[model samples]
Target: MAFRRYLKPRVVPQEVEQIVDALPHHNVGSQGYDPWGLNLDTAKISFTAVRWLYEHYFRVEAHGLENVPADGRLLLIGNHSGQLPMDGVMAAYAIATNPHGPRLPRTMVERWFPTVPFLGNFINQVGGVVGDPKNCGKMLEREEAIIVFPEGIRGSGKPYRLRYQLQRFGHGFMHLAMEHRTPIVPMGIVGCEETMPSVTNIKPLARMLGVPYFPLAPLVPLPAKVHICFGEPMHFPDDARDEGEVERRVERVKDAIRDLIDQGLAKRRGKF
Candidate 1:
């Protein structure tokens, strides 16, 4: 009992507590855990660690945050880069600290992430779920916000030569968005590609390791200045059923992100 008291106040900073407490979280039970294994205390602690990277290490600059609705069933779609998922981390932080109000967004993670010991559970505690269409559909129905990267490993694992060139986007997110009637806020992430700057992907090693393509890059991510531009929320008609129509709509979202990326690139002084 005494340990719990000590752990609560001292472990979690007061400012972080205020941020977490201020946010509106849905479907959390009396035990402080949600159906997806989100524990408020765990989120508070995790924020303390990621907050340093978001603020000091990466020196992230977030724009268009007000465009993110404070409450709703929505999708935060963005380009994925960097060997790690730091882009998503910074985006999550930006939304949580938006001027409008704090919001806890569930990030859709790759299935293989859960195969890693300890990492998966930590992710889940901080509101990461496997990127399954059914999972996303259920969350949207409950009015929970979600973050998705349609490019998956194709974007994240790409080599430095292809930086800023968006890979093909899966049509699944568009289908889910139209089906659920969820609005998508396109995010353009700049500077993460420079953080690690993969020269080549060690596909053989990745296959042996049973992971996605492993990159020959820096052991730790460099402190590149990250700029995240959040575009205005985009809503599509829920009536589209043809695959071609869905692909076209997805391209529209990609275009929004691409434009924002250009803005971010133009905004930066240099890649640090």
Candidate 2:
């Protein structure tokens, strides 16, 4: 009994076979039928795997999902961490594996993300778009839920000592929200900072290689329970367009996320 208790959870063979069986459905996007290059079948399969990690490994529990509207132009802004961008994966997973049904969130990634050969191609198949104003506006128009990390590369690659400490969020998302009049939902993801701890950023080497941040973390991430809390959707009137006004609204979102993060952190039993 003790040995069984310590054994890793069994990987369901049926689910794995189901995902493998659907590979043929991936034909939909191989020809670029969708501008975003998203293959719904592929996404479903990918989420199946991600859901396994979320359920058994991280044991992620997403709160306040109802706060997100069922249908509308939505922007999900959040804190990013886990040098591997697993925080983003977990956040995406939280939305994708909703109790009702699977709903993959359209995530915006750095431009350099798609330049990494096979990794880049996989990202495209699973609906990770390059971060840019044009791409964002288009996605919002499609009424898709987009997950944006305003902290960008900084949030993902910050030093281990500074984990959970938010960095400055750029003004792009703020401007996008106001322009499209889309509701912005702030999400705070806890436990990622502890999962993939970064020792330091190799700034010079990262820059030399044209990467945003080259930080060192364990070869495999540690198991950490993740909590994703979604704040109520915040509406920004179309009237606010000035730079100063935009900055203030951006701060409001950041403040909202910070508060949510604190709330999530307070609930941890063993900081797991």
Q: How accurate is candidate 2 locally (lDDT)?
A: 0.79
Q: What is the lDDT of residue 33 in candidate 2?
A: 37
lDDT of 2 by residue, 12-118 (tens): 24564444333323224455335777755455556667877899999988998878776667899999888877888888777654554345577899889888877
Give the 10-residue window scoring lowest on summed lDDT in candidate 2. Answer: 1-10
Candidate 1 TM-score over all chains jointly = 0.96
Please provide TM-scores, in order, for all candidate models, with all chains considered together: 0.96, 0.86
Note each model's CA RMSD in angstroms.
Answer: 1.7, 6.8
lDDT of 1 by residue, 194-236 (tens): 9999999998999999999899999999999999999999999
What Cα-based lDDT does every candidate model obtain? 0.92, 0.79
**Runs off by more than 4 Å, candidate 1:** 1-9
Backbone collisions counted per model: 0, 0
